[model samples]
Target: MHIAEGFLPVTHCVAWAAVATPFVAHGAVAVKKQLKAQPETKLLLAAAGAFSFVLSAIKIPSVTGSSSHPTGTALGAVLFKPPVMALLGTLVLFFQALLLAHGGITTLGANVFAMAIVGPWVAYGVWRASRGAGASMDLAVFLAALLGNLATYVVTATQLALAHHAQGLVQAWLTFMGLYAPTQVPIAVIEAIVTVLIVRALSKIAVPELQRLGFLPEPAQPVAQKVGI
Candidate 1:
């Protein structure tokens, strides 16, 4: 959900940009570490960027005369670290705004905060928590995707609330949440299912690639594979 320029007051835009600045800086540091550790990760980052660009551009019509698209941050976080995914997401949003006019330039910071930062960080946190619990790869992926999708809507609602507050609207936050929930909840469930299927397929055919990217668990006991086979 891209908030158009002029939709929010200048104060809110400045505030979000200020808050997001450190996140963008931390993302740069993470990208540097990833580059140092795996030189090939540059190519992977490029691919992720391209994939994110395409996925975000393909919008599905929604209520409110606006459209929604898969953030793709969860997928990237599952494949790489959240910081790197943030960078990829930022770049993708930048290009989407500049080239495609999919999102407004003035609201880029808000979009980055919501789709790039919130989604990836939530997904990463969920995945890490699940991993610590000895959850299966599929389960980890499912949880990450679920949280990511939900976080997107939450962030969007918060942004809309801020906008309404700036306009001196009554009960702005609650109103925004009520308006957006009807559309976002179903979309989140659909996205989670799609993410699970994609991750499951990748887990089966390209386990090594996932391992190299630090995305999947270490090989389970050999018997696990035999049972599936």
Candidate 2:
């Protein structure tokens, strides 16, 4: 979900942009290093960004300035790691701001900080934790995407509360989150399922690519059978 144009105060917008700049900068370097090392991943990377763009573009109005939508960021975080996803997510938001008027250029930085940086890291962390606990890839991805989408809304709620804190920060946050919950929860569940399906499909077609990215392990060779002669 995006914070629409002119929805946020100018000072808040600048502050958020300043905070997000370093992460986006680091992400650019990470992306360059990744492509240089594994040029084969470019297509997959593009697909990840496209997936996020398409899903996130489906906005349902919620709250005052924000909306509710599935954030399709977990796939990229799982495949390329969170750093790479920061760039991809920001790019998707940027295009949507300019072309689709979904989000605003003024609010781009805040949106990036939430949906791009915080969301991907949360998703990646969930994925790693779930896998470490011996969960299957599909289950891990589902949890990662679900929790990541929720995390983005939490951050957005906090941002809104901070900007409009007359009723107090905690109360305002609760209000925003309560409004978002009805739409966002179902959307998060759907996003998680869709992310799992995408990961499974990619695993079949992009085994080598996934292997290179450390998302898939190499296959073991067959043992020789004893001769019966």
Candidate 3:
């Protein structure tokens, strides 16, 4: 669902770039801190970046000439922190735009805002909530992935509405949401199931890997109070 360059008006592009700059900067700093805190995480992040790039490229056609694909934010957030996921996503998008031409440079900021910022943060938020309640990790991961994918479309719809507004199009924001939600929701559900299955298998074989990668907290000797995210 990468919005091409020139799809949005120049004004919207400039506005989104301005708004997204600080978040992008903050995300980069967080990634740097993560690398320093755990040097091995750099390898994990690179692997996730490569994985995301490949995953996002495999798309299923949707209405409106858009396509559905795995957001990959859930996997990243489950392996690394959300901020780190954002960095990984940015790198993946950069390479995709450069090599594959999957997305455009001009719309990079908006794409990052939708997929990287909104998706990972949504997943992380759900993960945190579920973990605090001592919910099953598998279930939490599923819901987090589901919400992240759904939120990507929501954010994209908002961005599109904003672009239309700048261009004086008659379409309303709610209208855009209404049109996009029908297509996005079903795909999101499928993504959630896939993510849950993968995480479940990973948890069985490599629980410590999850912990080391910051997906799960260090296990307590007797299992301490539940923590989220």
Candidate 4:
């Protein structure tokens, strides 16, 4: 959910921006290192960014009179890790704000914090944990995308509640959460399925790229036998 321009107070806007700065900065370094180390995956990285941008840009009408959209941050987070998505996600938000007026420049930091920073981290963690527990790649990706999308909304609701909490903080949060859940739930599931499909397709077609990104395990080498005999 892109908070409208000028919706948040100046103090809140500044506070969010300050909090989000370091993550974006770290993300910048991570991107540079990744590109230098694996130059071949540059196109793959661009595809991930495009996926996030296209999905997030398709705003849907929410039951709360606000809008809801898919937070497509999970794919990049799962592929390149959370830090990489942090930068790509921010770039997606920046361009959306500038060109589409989907979000505003003033609230860029808050949007980035929710959609880029927290969402990717949550997705990456879920993906890692699910895989560690022996979940299939499809299952892990599905769970990661679903939870990550929901987490973004939860954080956005928190930000809104904090900014406009004259009616008591807890009440405000509950109200916002209630309004968002109706639309966001189905969208999250859809995003999860879409992510899984994309990953599945990539598994077949982009095997080398996925292996380079560590999405696929490297092939094991055979050992020489009978030499001693």
Candidate 5:
């Protein structure tokens, strides 16, 4: 959910910026630490970031004024964790502003909060929890990707409601959710399936890489079945 430039009130923009800054700082530090430990992952990191960037850019029109796209953060979050995704997501959003002219500078903080901070963390939580509960990789991946994208829109709706609602916050929240849920439901399913597909590919082509990233044990067997995206 890319928020257009100058759409949010100044106070909301400033508040969100202030809140998101520390997470970005932590993300950068975490990435540096990861690189120091696993230099081989540099290329993997690039590919993961590119996946998030490229998928999010293909927006599908939704509601009256906004559009939907796969956040694409869930896969990276599951592999690399949420902090690095936050850092990479910030750069992705900034690049989208500069190149695609989708989300804007003014609203970067809010967008980052939704897509980077909350989305990844939620997805990662679901992933870990599901895995801990002995869920299948496919099921964990699907839940992570699906719920993460939904969380992004939920947070965005909350931000919008807080900033612009003439009605009370609850009412505004409900309104925005109603507006986004229709298209977002299908989009979430599509994004989750795509994420599973990508992870399945990585598991096959990059088994060693996945082992190094702690996504799989060194002796793990392949689990990719015929999955429809």
Candidate 6:
């Protein structure tokens, strides 16, 4: 969900931009370190960014009148972790705003916070948590995408509620959430399935790249060849 241009108050926009700055900065640092460690990550990073831009740009109208779509942050978060994913995600947001007019500059901070930073960070946590809880990679990836998509909508609703704090914040928040949930819930489920598909394809051919990016464990085993009789 994007907060359209000038939709938020100036103060609200500036406040969110301010809040998102350091996280972006930290993400930049993480990107630098990752590139230094695994130069091959650049191509994968580009693919991840492109994935986010393509999927997230396909916004379907929702009850909020704002529209909803897949975040695509789960793939990046699972592959690169939040710090790196946050950096990549912001790039996607900026480009979409600049070239595609999908989002806007004033609301850039708020959008970035919701879709880029918080969503990926939460997804990364869910991915790790699910993996630690002995879930399969498929399940982990699904939960990451599903929960991450939900988290983004939640953050967007909160931002709208805060901006309209003239209305009771709690009521506004719940109202905004109610408006978005119908579209977002189904979008989240679709995103989870899509993420699993993407991960499965990558797992088959990009084990080294995935392992290098820390998505796969060290000493990753090669995919076993299936011999046809």
Give the Cα error of residue 220 in candidate 4, in Å.
2.2
Q: Tell me, by TM-score, which candidate is best.
A: 4
The CA lDDT of each predicted structure is 0.77, 0.92, 0.77, 0.93, 0.92, 0.89
How many pairs of residues collide in model 6? 0
Better of 3 and 4 by TM-score: 4
Candidate 2: C-alpha lDDT: 0.92
lDDT of 5: 0.92
In angstroms, the error of model 6 at 91 is 1.2
Report the C-alpha lDDT of model 6 over 1-229, residue by residue, as the tens digit. 7888988999999999999999899999998998898898788888888888888989899766658889899898889888887788888899888988888989999999999999998999999999999999999999999999999999999999988867799999988999898899999999999999999999888888988767777783456633432
lDDT of 1 by residue, 80-180 (tens): 86787777778888888888887778788888888889898999899989988999877887888878977877788788876778555557767776665
TM-score of each: 0.84, 0.94, 0.84, 0.96, 0.94, 0.92
- Candidate 1 pairs with clashing backbones: none
Candidate 2 stretches greater than 4 Å from native: 62-66, 222-229
- The better-scoring model by lDDT among 1 and 4 is 4
> Ten-residue segment with the worst summed lDDT in candidate 4?
220-229
* Residue-wise C-alpha lDDT for candidate 4, range 1-229, written one tens digit per residue: 8887998998888999999989999999999999999999998899999999999999999867878999889999999998998889889999999999999899999999999999999999999999999999999999999999999999999999999999999999999999899899999999999999999998998899899888999776555543533
Candidate 5 structure quality by residue, lDDT tens digits, 39-148: 98888898889999998998998865568888999988999999999999999999999899989999999999999999999999999999999999999999999999
Candidate 3: regions farther than 4 A off: 166-171, 217-229
Which segments of model 5 are wrong by more than 4 Å? Answer: 63-65, 220-229
Sort by TM-score, best first: what order? 4, 2, 5, 6, 3, 1
Clashing pairs in 4: none
Task: Write model 3 residue lDDT over 1-229, tens digit each, in one string.
Answer: 7777788888777787777677778889988887888785565667667656776776677675556677878878767767877777877777788888877888888988888888998998898899889989888988899998888888887888877775454465676776666667787888888788777776686666568876767766543434432
